[model samples]
Target: MSVVWYFDFISPFAWLQWPHIKALAEERPVTLRPVLLAGVLDRVGQKGPAEIPAKREFIYRHVLWRARQAGYPLHFPPRHPFNPLAALRLCIAAGSGVPATEAIFDWIWGQGREGDTIEALAPVATGLGIAEPAAAVADPAVKAQLKANFEAAMAEGVFGVPTLSIDGRLFWGSDAHDFALACLRDPDLWEEAEMHRVAHLPVGASRL
Candidate 1:
């Protein structure tokens, strides 16, 4: 089985799942697909966590705590809510492997480096020994690839970063990794009859 990992580099929570995904790669094929979280929110008619102050605060602490628990280093960038277009494009340009993707994640979230602009990202790429950072980011092919990635993700029912899709069954959020792993181990758990039954269940009275 293969796991399609949909992610955006700007998300700290997405960064938290990097290590877990690497671990899972040892067991099965894992493809890292870069998608714009802004595009996802737009398509799903939802606001990002950072757009809600209360949730944003909670997310920061929660992600940090989770990272600590997972023994992964995490530091929020000095400025958040920055456009990750260039970085996302860069990942695609670099072939979206574990090394290149993790390098992008490490520079942005791990070391708290600024990567909002191509100028800012150039140094990070240089540090990672990536050639032609400027050309890579500016390439029209990279831009097209990123757009295609976003569109494909939307078509697959992805509404957020760090989503895992195994044979069209989606498991969203960093916390859902364990559940996705479980699903992978037991493909029979996706009982269609039970799912149809739940889907047709009558709704209880709403408190509202």
Candidate 2:
């Protein structure tokens, strides 16, 4: 069975999880699914961590720390909270695979490049061997695919990037990387009758 990694380039946490998940791909099939984090946040009526003040502060610092710990260079984009629509669309155009996705993430987070617009991203795209990135990003099919991915993610109960889905269960956030790997290693971990029951339970059932 393949594990699905739902991601958005705008998220530093997603960037952090990329290497780990890529390594996991060696052991199991991993599908990289690009979805818009903004759309997910809008649908779930949630806010990005960087949108909140205290969390934003911590995120800036922690992301850098985490990057160092992981041995990856981390640099926040020059502008915070910039639109990621164009970049996301470009990812769709680039096949949404590890190479393209890693290039996109590196351009924004690793190189500290600004990526809010097609104009700003064109050079990065060129460097990544994606010919005509601007035009490809605007292609109708690419646009639709990104939207479809977002909706599909929502339908699958995905509320955040760096989310891993295996056996129909979602493990969210970069912190869940190890747990997801464990689940992949042992599919039987969620094979019990109670696990199946939990999967089908109504939302907020315990609260109700």
Candidate 3:
């Protein structure tokens, strides 16, 4: 089973899930699917939670509690950018073994910037002990490839960031973290549970 992490760097929930989502794969066959989150949101007419006063308030309280429970650092970012696809693309090209993956998430969600240029990203990249050349990836090809990745995601029915898509079923939002983790960490239990929260978990008669 595979997990597609349709995330935008602007999503605090996506940021919050990064460490745990990676942990869920410790003993599993999961890979990160980084896509252009803004494209999904724009195409779907979905707005970032931070733009919604009530929803933003809701998420702040929710994330604080989840952070406490998850035992990880958490804070609402001071500023939120509407687009994060470029940042996600850089990380996608970055090897999975690199430490910069978390740095990318933190730079966006913790410090509240997309690290748009190589100069901007270099600090985070090297801080995480990864060598990031600001010039090498300036080619048009890199940008094109990233755009194509987003297109592919849309073809898969992805309409929002923090979307967890497995097979053809889509679970959108930060609240679905438990189901996503369960789908990866405890697939059988997910299937057996009343609601197969994650998309691909075998459900209905499939559970039996």
Candidate 4:
């Protein structure tokens, strides 16, 4: 089965996870599905880590530590929680291939560039051989494709960026990459007693 990666450019974790997911392309088919993280969060009725004051500060520090530990170069853009609609649509316009996808991630996360506006992302598009970045991303079909991707992600129960779906199982977050890889190597691991127990664990209480 193919690995479907649901992500949004607004997430640094998605950027951090890009290389590992790209590596998987060498072994099997990998599809890059760009969707709006904001839309997903709204649908789930949850605040993003960055949307919470204390968690925002902690998450920034946490990701920095994780980047240092992983030896991945990371620089936050001028801002966090910027609009990523243009960038997401750009991915659809650019065919969502490895090169284009990596370049978009690198432009924002690696180079610490702004991706909220079409003008800010024009260079990335031009470099990728798309002369008219704004026009390309504004295409009706491109916008429609991004919407479709988001709808499909919702249908698949994806609630976060950088979620990996394989063989009907979802592994969310960059930290879960190893576990996803292990499951990929051994699909039957889900059959373990602990796995079954956790799957049906009873909730003692609920905040809702």
Ranking by TM-score: 4, 1, 2, 3
What lDDT, from 0 to 1, does candidate 4 have? Answer: 0.91
The total number of steric clashes, by the backbone 3 Å criterion, in model 2 comes to 0
Clashing pairs in 4: none
- Stretches of candidate 3 above 4 Å error? 82-86, 96-98, 110-117, 127-132, 181-208
Compute the lDDT for candidate 3: 0.65
RMSD (Cα, Å) for all candidates, in order, is 2.2, 2.8, 6.3, 0.9
Candidate 4 lDDT by residue in tens digits, 75-141: 9999998999989888888999898899899999999999999899999998888988888988999
Task: Give the Å error, residue 138, model 4.
Answer: 1.0
Relative to the unseen true structure, what is the C-alpha lDDT of residue 98 in candidate 2, on a scale of 0 to 100? Answer: 75
All candidates' TM-scores?
0.91, 0.89, 0.72, 0.97
- Model 2, runs deviating above 4 Å: 191-208
Cα deviation at 108, candidate 4, in Å, is 0.5
lDDT of 3 at 207: 31
What's the number of clashes in each of the models?
0, 0, 0, 0
lDDT of each: 0.86, 0.86, 0.65, 0.91
Q: lDDT per residue, candidate 3, 22-54, as tens digits? A: 775576555566666666768887786667899
Best by TM-score: 4
Q: Who is ahead in TM-score, 1 or 2?
A: 1
- Best prediction by lDDT: 4
